[model samples]
Target: MEAVRATEIMVAAGARELRDGQTVVVGLGLPQVACVLARRTHAPALSLLLEIGVTNMNPVDTPIGLADSRIFYRATCWSGFLDILGMNLHRGVVDVGFLGALEIDRFGNINTTLLKEDSGKLRYFNGSAGGNDVASLAGRVIVIMRHEKRKLPTAVAHLTSPGFPGGRSRKDLGLRGEGPQRIITDKAVLGFDRGTHQATLLSLHPGVELQDVIENTGFRMETPKTVPATPLPTPEELRLLREEIDPKNVYLG
Candidate 1:
């Protein structure tokens, strides 16, 4: 018997957004797993750009990070970070960029640098190395994060990477790409409203109700007139995700 885990549902939601032939800039974490699932399932022709300067690699195992050599398993090209980031990404040629954050605001700003503690002290986290650059360049960014009230704050304590700064137009900020197109969470999927650019509930995961989403979110989300439930992972998707993509349960677990 095949069982679908809740985490797998989030992974599949990320994969469903990918197209057949698009260039994706992949960061570490579940974003990597989601990209791999996309390639192996529907978007076989997807070109993956690793921060380490590898592109279109068919990895056999789940890589620990961008520096993992598994990224070079059968790479189409091995270039330097300069060529990938400066030339390609800066030019906004990459179609989709996947990211994760510890704190996200209603405006989509992300804070991975620091968080406030109960004692009123600032606790530092791993700083954004290339995330800011990626958000600034990718044609569209999709953030994958665990859903929790605290993580989804009304405003991030510190902005490590700008999403739609203050929900302003991308043109207003002189950004090359549209910031944070969608946010995939364990409980629901949120997208930016076209006019307001505020986080809007797009769909809820299976068994997650409207109130459940409302309670978990830190800020008030714009509820759509008709919020659909995210499609559950099919047997095939679950099999591929579990057996082929992340057999070791690195990210899916």
Candidate 2:
């Protein structure tokens, strides 16, 4: 247990959100690792689709990127982006849009592109390679990112992907994908309120304080009556993570 790391916990938390037979469109970073963890654990039938045209990915090692050969290795199907992003994604067959973010707001809006002059120093990101499309088309979305004040801003300076925006709902915008359902971070798991769409505090990780989540968030979130400790990763989950999934510390590192 002592060797278990925060990144492991984060991956485990994100993985648990996936059900046994859900279809997921995974992004490049921790999201992809979490998807793999899900398939190897409880969701053995989980369909992992990368927008880069790989389907049913069971990577022996965490891929460096969506285009990495390891992600395509032993995959069930190797189609082009049109079949994946254009067809499966656009057709609304994706069950989950597992994504990472540079910054996310209380409304779950994510910014993976440039912060721009609004955030001080102007910076350019790779833009939303498939982020906007995934968020717009998946049946539901889940975000995985580190817990930090800067990363969890009151509002993202640049909105690369849509969420439950401050004023309008995803439906009002005519977006097909259900907006963010859960945000998994190192410190806590935050869920969106059904009515308000605000990122509500749900559970804190073991040894993480309420104040830790609060202070790390850019905007204050409403505390529920009970914020339980996140269920620690099971022994088997930890074992698989360390020994099978990321033994070399690729993504877990």
Candidate 3:
């Protein structure tokens, strides 16, 4: 892991979370690379849903983005947003949802909208796009974000995706999914502590230290007595990622 780039490690960590035959809602960037990697390796039957309505795409080449026509090669169908998000997701047919965040709190609440500056200025972002739907309706959500103190605030200025907001229950919010099941970062794999509703260290990356994880986070995360290191990416896995998935070094670069 030390020899590899951080983004590569992040992609590997992301790819490992996907299980065989699970219908996953994924975006175009690193998540798509992860999906392609999963299909080439252990999870050959994993189905991918792109936000732009392409379903079950078997990409012949690494697509630059959802707008790239390469994803349409042997795609299952090209439905509209209503069918994918309004129906499949709202109906709870999707098993997992992948989301990226501008900021995430210790409770996992996400902010993909505007960032509030110290002067009370709002720096607007593309407000939610399909993130709200994906987070709200999927069976379970897995967030992909790089761990940094600025991005990992104690709380987001705005809550675009609910993740145990204020340490409450999802049932109370009436959200369909199980909220955030896992948070995958370059440094560690984290899961919420049931008692504290705070991010807890589930596993660390191969060369990342506990202090590194702690110092980078905006809030204090609970650490167990024994934390396992995330399994290093296999050589075959690396090959698939480099030669097959993202040969152009699009995201893995």
| Tens-digit per-residue lDDT, 72-113, candidate 2 | 889999997799888898987888999999999999888999
Inter-residue clash pairs, candidate 2: none
Q: Relative to the unseen true structure, what is the C-alpha lDDT of residue 4 in candidate 3, on a scale of 0 to 100?
A: 72
Clashes of each: 0, 0, 0
Predict model 3's lDDT versus the native.
Answer: 0.84
Better of 1 and 2 by TM-score: 1
Q: Report the error of model 2 at residue 223, Å.
A: 0.8
Q: Compared to the true structure, candidate 3 yields what TM-score?
A: 0.95
Cα-based TM-score, every candidate: 0.96, 0.96, 0.95
- Report lDDT (Cα) of residue 178, candidate 1: 79
Full ranking by TM-score? 1, 2, 3
Cα-based RMSD of candidate 3:
1.6
How many Å off is the CA of 190 in candidate 2? 0.4
- Show the colliding residue pairs in model 1: none
lDDT of each residue in 133-196, candidate 3, tens digit only: 8888888888877888889888988899888898887887787778787888888888987776
Q: Compare the candidates by lDDT and give the number of the best one.
A: 1
Local accuracy of candidate 1 as per-residue lDDT tens digits, 17-94: 999999988888899888888888899999888878898888887887888898789988999788788788887789
Query: Which sections of candidate 1 miss by over 4 Å?
Result: none
